[model samples]
Target: MSQVRTKVILYNPKAVFYTMPLALIALASYLDKGIYDVKIIDGRLEKDPLMKILDSCEGAVCFAVSVLTGAPIKDALEMTIEVKKRFPELNIVWGGWHPSLFPLETLKETPVDVVVRGQGEIAFEQILTAIINGQSFQGIAGVSYKDKVTGEIVQNAERNMVDINSFPAFNYDFVPVNSYEKLSGRNQIDYIASQGCRFRCNFCADPFMYKRGWYGYAPTRIADELETLWDKYHFEHVHFQDETFFTIGARVEAIAEEFIKRKFRFSWFGTMRADQGSRLPDEVFAKCKASGLERVMIGLESGSQRMIDWMKKDIKIPQVYESAQKCLKHGIAINFSVIIGFPGETEADMDETIRVVTDLRKMSPEFRVSIFYFKPYPGNEIADALIADGYKMPQGIKEWSDFDYVVKGSPWIPEKKFREIENFKFFQRLAWSKPSLLKTPIQTLAKWRIKNKSYHLPIERKLIELIFDRQKLS
Candidate 1:
């Protein structure tokens, strides 16, 4: 009898932005040199992803789709349903943040045949082996799949975190060479130097996804990868896509030293917690900038200490200011991820946040602020509290897909308050673009005024918005 080869199709559903699908690329690279045949389809760039997937599914053993909790889930589910109709014999799998959090629920709610819970590379490879050998899917770690005969959902043991250097470098052949960039005219590529985070912020899903285990590649390994990309592909910027790039200060210093030794010139940016930056010395920031660290994003969730405590952020408000100042002094651009409309936040709390951000802008003209309305996602401490307080949760994959961090927020926030937040975001952008000596004084004075409990007065609020709003510059 002739031998039949094993084939699997991986799908990257549409996202809010078009970045490299590192997860799919990593999986493809893992399976590429093995017995299994792998193909990747990015829904964001495809003219017709469903048709492309259908065409690719010919003689394929399984179709796997990875997703987040938001709109991407809808995209993945839609693709899975249509693929199932056309090829019912094919195995359908779901992985990534959403499925890893709710494996059984995902298998019960969707048409997916299997759910690969955590660290999918090893589990997925094992799945291919089992299918090829005509063995049972039972005893596979980090997976949930329905039984063929009884059709009962079988949840397997959770998988441990994988070593950082276990996988090979990403195979860029599956994706377009020109498709990835951090910004227009910036030939940048995003790279994940590490996996997992150790923090347990009440509102974050990192704890659930990684189970508080942080792991990263060696400094030399990361630098080697970056230099190879820069030398070979002409990429000038490296966006470190770690959840918190500055988790280990010594490791980062080592990375900077490696880059310095190599004499590589590449501007880079990464996200970090405010406390992490505060713990680092001024020399570290200078060293990083000297080695091409252009920007660092800090999650300054709130300016109010009370709100910070409520969020269980552990970091104090003073630490945030100190970190911002250090970054500004070192000529490193700061991107602040601020959140408004927390469950119990008062108008006074909101005023404090605005005042603090205004001061941050004064410190650095290169400040980039991203303000988001707080949305309660599943499997988070804050989301559970919100649900307990009568907030409605999304029921199915379709409903979950509608949840977006940028455009949508908690329903408990009043329409008036919501409009103010919208207006604040509009003004914050303006203030950053047109910073001057005159505006700094006015902003400081306004901060003092708002701090004194005059925030609720209509005239006072409108005056604050007018002075800071970006539209005024136009």
Candidate 2:
């Protein structure tokens, strides 16, 4: 009697614990009849046991192995190599944003036997079915793999998943709810009511990914999925994984109105463009909050006029403050992500940023500020220009790799100076301003420890040590 071979897959690396990549694969599992005994390893809960991941499965797939987001690709590749080292006959694959952008480079650098780029819902299922039948991946759509016989790069045209409803709701059964709850500050899981984005921000690939088109799910369908999650899992919160959640206000209004009608006041959060906040007044925010829009993340690329124009962000500094003020007044908790360095920023530019963070803090003590280094993603105007001009990304000396690795293109500010601006001193000025409650730094990490005990201990220690060391030297 022949033994049945089980299919195993592993996913790792998430920016937010609100959503899981394994959920997408599990959706594929629903279409499957369990003929192959499918299994999943969620890296978000904790790092997966690599040897076990390799030894346990006949075939497997990983996500995001190409761009800056996949900066630690060498580590990801090494894992696959280890798997192949142990099981010479095992099949390995890669997927997500990194693969979608640089499939060719990924094939060369990693032991990724195959890659599924873009939306891999149907494509993933097809790959498993084909491998089970002992077929080659020559004709798989949205997949790229080596042509062993031809010794050439073989890639299929990108296939975008338009019917998001066709995909099953994100499942938490595979991942412990406690683990996710601990990381994301909510007990509920999330789903994509929409896919792709329409904005043409030069630094982001959303517009590039969808050919500048945005796709959304039906309101009824979305409501049905959320209702199922609430009804079945007894979940009381949700996170919508939409790039610009209120891109079409009507869709959002419809969803919010449905919640009001059903009395489903579930806590939820979503990302949105900053300018839109000005248009949505206090009444709209009250409605959203009542229906459960607890938090919103807005990206303020920079406070400097010159820096803002260079990135072609379209939105201006005044708009940022206005939008921020509106959100604050409305009682809608705001989580801001600010970009510090960009092309041609001066001391004045950095100071302007200090001013913005200072004012925003005055509005509320509960407001959260997330500071990030500027990055030039692929297919972006800035990235293309930089690569054309022989720009080198700087990895921080003390802090190792992070979003800070990408040195901004500003000619006036050296990478070190930019790092200094982001360091502890910049934050101390603002934090020391108010003696009440012992203010945390406006810059987040003052080259020193940030006040948020929620942050990792190592990061906190390093930041504190770095800032203190710098202070002692001064």
Candidate 3:
């Protein structure tokens, strides 16, 4: 007779987007099925997630949550606190971006027993083994735990980054792909072909988390797994969620060739840097296009050369244009994300960004530009510098819950400048958006306002906001 396998429940907190919980899935899939029974509960999909989680925790030995930096922290905390209230003996683990950044800090919370840092597959396995055998977490690398007897936090040495190829392929059966498709309004699957990032942008957290290390699955492995997934799910699209999917040009080329050779019938998208895109040969681009490359997202963080250099973007402004021209030539859609409101940025710098955005918008209607204010996310060079210069970060979970990277206003930006940037964003969206019968006139006026830089009376914006606010409340 087989021994009973202990249940391990993994929870993914509710998020704004419908993207599947790949992180939780990673932890779940890494566990050995013979000894551990892992059940993943995504808060986003449940009507009463807390009740469901409590129901599932009846016989579970461990309750692990994957948390991000912002609003998800609130939900995760609430759920974990409730779980601790009910199942005091169960080991509660917190892992992912927020916990990785603040391992010791996260342990101060009453619920979280252990915090897993970077690349948690191996570490998570060790943690589970230790918990099951009633062993000490003293020697577990990449883990921080509170001593049960002494009540002191112990942070182990950091673990080196591991190659993703060594891990088991993602088990899509763990998630309801059809439900995700319905939620996203696209018959697509989200996948991470690689882990960590090589580039060290000052505003990014990848460098501090991964120590500038990067690893990707072998192209053949990715192709084989994707083919199996396609056959199983019949999805039409694959969205690669890697930070820098095109880091190795030859690897990208090989992946594309595999996709083409397999005769896969799905389109795909990935993230790319301007420097990487510019350096790719024309033939490589052609191969990718032929292999169902539908769209690519490029982070052109700033337009001013000086700002780019200051941020350690390591790419020239000319490379941005070069990449754009290549994408246009290949008939691919491009989404260029730009950041504004950085520390020490001037009006002249904002103007340069606007000029570049306008030029990119004019390139092709298929090209899209997304503008956002720079939020000082921790675990980055800029955030470290700000901390050194006396910038106070959020103290605890409640404070961090209010941190919104996309919509939050930065302290460095004055009110007038903020309004100006907001108006520009509104007009820029309307001016380049696909027009309908009701929006053509508004689009024309928006274009005129953008051209003349005249945003004195934004009555339309106010009215639209009023309508949306009412709808949201209703």
Candidate 4:
């Protein structure tokens, strides 16, 4: 008898922007330890990802894909359908956010042979073992599959959440790390220090997936990984991809102290809720700043108190102000994540949000406000209400994949109001989002005008056009 080499293909579908595919890299590290031969394909970085997958499908045992909601789902299904057409005998497994929430729905709709729910480190390893030995899929946990003989769906027990602290470090050798830097135009990369979240906001999917479970790796281990990233790749800025970085305050302080003691000055940023921010001491922020903490992204959601209560955000308007003040006082940048066009939002509510953001913009040049139209995502409380109130959910994977969060999610909002929202986004971008040599003095004057109750004639649009043209010339 001769021995056969096991080969597997792992993929990350297209996302809003090109990022280093850490998920694929992490899975490969565990699978490639003299077990299986793994190949990674990041669609965002590839010119033709479909062709790459087709070319690599030579005697492969599994074709695994990770996907998100919205556009990425659509893109993943397209690739899956093509792969099946060419290699009918290969096993296609779907994992990650979308498939985890609706495992049966995904299995019925797409050509996927299996859906690996929850964290994939252990489940994926077992699946590979079964495939290599030609065993039955009866005992696998956290997986939904179709019976080969009966052709019926069989879902096993849900997988328990694993302690990610023990997971091996990502194998960056699978892909070129320098390619990501060229695309981003900076010395930046993303790293995950924690998993899960502690809140159940109605518009989010993290709660449903992790069941509000929060976990973090040890501070010393985090420091070790970050040092490796810097020493090996010269990475300067790290984007932490946790649901909320401050779920545990003591861990944050420990991580900060570890970085400070090691004399590592890698700039970093992460998200925290406004309610969480209100409890942190000023000394923590100062220490973190000294250790290269540059900014914190806080979800303000809405400026109207009534709207805030409606969303069950559980944070007071005064807390929002306090969070912003704390960051500004310590010289840390604040990125305000705002939302409008919820189910019962009014024009008055939108006006109040605009007024609040406009006031916050005057406090510091580093303050940033990003506005997005609400989307009724699957498995969220708001999505259920929207469906009950006569809103039609997407019929299948294709329809759901086309869902856009930037536009109105429901059809209840009038066309006129939708156009008004678009115009407001344009003006907000001109005032707060863009970089301009004329920003400091001009914005300072605009702040003075608003504070003095003097409504000056509008000239920003014309001035922005002139600036754009000058940049084009240069």
Candidate 5:
């Protein structure tokens, strides 16, 4: 063969998880080294008609599957098997949260030849190039691989986390500029300024991934990346995938300054904690908004202090209220994310959450509530316990975390309850998960305005009247 390019990574662009830029970081390294020909495709958010993913990279020594998307676990694994069956020379691999914890199970069950139990950027690159060069991968850090001779899984020593500067700014040349426009109706791209979370929320997978170190990209580099995207790709919007944009409020302020300096600011969104929002100064909030941070999502998790205590969320009722005031005053729209139906849920908890959402709405007409059912993602701390408790879930459990799957998954919530008041499933099915019905019109107009408009954020009162009004009419 004259030359062979034998590595690729597939990101399910349609996934609710929009954090594939990390994988892109690793792919960029492979391309720069010139040791292998590498290509990456974000299948998420893309409207690619043909299934050209597997066929795109031939004799691919290895493929990296992004598991955070959660939609493609079964299909991505199946595709790996199919690729292996068709191309006998190729090695299929799986990574990210889904495969990392279940290395042996995933490897044996699927066509996956390798699993990167930790960060994959370097480990995957090293392992793939070795496989291509017909070399040994005995000591590569952060890899779980089956020995060709023994067929036993070998997990190498742990890989230290990456410094942000080790990688280049995201180069989207692999993606057509038109693709972003076509998919989002805006030039939407995602970037991350950080790698790990500080807290150990029982309901999340961060505790398993990051352990306890704080990692972040350089501020100037991030600002530069934004400018580069704007200059090169004509990208007009960004959704920062940072776990908490305000965790390092200073860094966020620096980023805003850079954006203001560069004149490349675009409408952006990111998630932050309630505590961060409350502590965030009005000046910083103003800078964020002026820098085009139009929307900020807060993970309130629960209205019940009991539930918060149990999940170790470390939030206070007052923090929620203060955060609302800060967001509203700064002209930044708030999308409050609430999680209900954890193990210790009661009527009062639900009542309090409804109250908080309603009060936030009165503070500003732009406030919206995004209520989600408690999910035990594959690697979440609760998954093992729940699976052991013999709690049988319906087949739709795969998509239960997704709002679109809420209709089918809702039956598990309260068999007779959701149909009347908080029937997310009804709207999910009737409206086909349309945005018009899910959060926008229903939250601000019909559901949230139940209380008088005021500076005080209400957390346990009727704020809007969408579902109840319809019921009254009926």
Candidate 6:
């Protein structure tokens, strides 16, 4: 007779993007299938996600949720609260960036019984084993939990990052690939070929989270998994969500060769640093483009060399131009993201950034420029400095929910500067956008306005806003 297997429910909270919850899938795929029955319910995909979650909680060993740092926290909190109310004995676990950053704070304030800090596959498996044996979670590395008897949160020693190749590839069977395809309106698969970033950009949290370490699956392994997944899903594109896809030029070349040799019929997108792109050989770029490389995102944070150094971006201004030329030559679409409004940044600094953005925009119609205001996120050198100087972070989850990257306005930016940036962002979009039959005249006017630095008496902006508002109402 077979023994009864324990049930585990993994949930993904609602968020702005429709990307697949690979973190939950990774954990689910790593668990022992013989002793556990796992159920994954994504809030974004469900109409009655709360009902589904509560239903799945019954007879489950634990209900786990993967969380991010911003708006998703609000929904995750609401769902977890209801689960805790109905099934008080069920272990509610939280993992992902937010919990990994503030494990003790999460355990103390929220209903989460355990917080899995970093590199959760091995640690999470150990956690489940402890739960099944009714044993203490005293020695589970990378875990923080409240002692059931003592009622004190016990923080475990940090877990060493393990080689991802040691684990099984993600099982896309955990979620409906078609649903994501429909949601994103693209025949694309979101994949992560690596974990952690080796960069130490002061404004980025990656360095703290990954400790300036990086690891990737073997090229053969990545190609093998992608081919298998393609055979199953038939996706036309693979969006590699790696932080730095071209970190190792040799590995990138090998991966491209593998894809070419396998005759994979899918285009791919990934990210690169300006320095990395500038250093890549023309032959490697040719190999990648031949392997269906459609686009690459390069983070050109600032045009001002002084500001770039201050941010520790480590890429010179000339490197940005070189990277752009290389991508343009390869006929690859490039999205260059720029950030303004850093603390202590002057008007001159902002002007320099705009200058670079404008120059890059002129490089090619295939090149795209995205402008954003800097938001201070914790666990980064900049945020730590601000905190050290008495810049209070959000007190709880409610405050943190407001920390969104896409939102306009930053505390450091004055109202006048903020409005100017907002106006420039709008006009910049119109100035460089592909000319539509109906909007060519407006695009021409936008280009003239940008060239002349004439934003005052912005009738076009007013009219556009009115039309948008009317459309929303209609």
Ranking of predictions according to TM-score: 6, 3, 4, 1, 5, 2
lDDT of 4 by residue, 224-243 (tens): 98898789888889888888
- Per-residue CA lDDT of model 2 for 290-367, tens digit only, reads 788788888776667777676776777777777777677766777777776565567788777656765665566445
Judged by lDDT, which candidate is best? Answer: 3
Stronger candidate by TM-score (5 vs 6): 6
Model 1 Cα lDDT, one tens digit per residue, 1-474: 644557889999988766688888888888845466788898987889999999999999989998888889988989999999999988898889999888888888888888998688889888878877777679998888999789999988878988869888877776775765632346888789998888888989888878999989999999888877777778788878899999999998998889888988778898878888999988888889889999998998988989999988888989988898898789898888888888888878887888788778767667877778877778889888778978788887677888776655456567876766665664455445555786676455444443453334446446655666543441
Global lDDT of each model?
A: 0.81, 0.62, 0.90, 0.81, 0.65, 0.89
Candidate 6 or 2, higher TM-score: 6
98-165 per-residue lDDT for model 3 (tens digits) = 99999878998547999999888999999999988899899899999999999899989999888888
lDDT, residue 48, model 3: 98
The C-alpha stretches of model 2 lying farther than 4 A from their native spots are 1-6, 13-19, 22-30, 34-36, 46-48, 58-68, 183-185, 393-412, 415-420, 423-474
Instruction: Please tell me which predicted candidate would have the highest TM-score against the true structure.
Output: 6
Q: Runs in model 6 with CA error above 4 Å?
A: 436-438, 465-474
Candidate 5 TM-score, true structure as reference:
0.82
Among all windows of 10 consecutive residues in model 5, the one with the lowest summed lDDT is 425-434
Candidate 6 Cα lDDT to native: 0.89
Q: Cα lDDT of model 4 overall?
A: 0.81
Lowest lDDT sum, 10 consecutive residues, model 4, at 465-474
What tens digits encode model 6's per-residue C-alpha lDDT throughout 38-119?
9899999999999999998999989999989988888999999999999998998999999888888888888899999878
Off by over 4 Å in 5: 1-22, 42-54, 387-417, 420-474
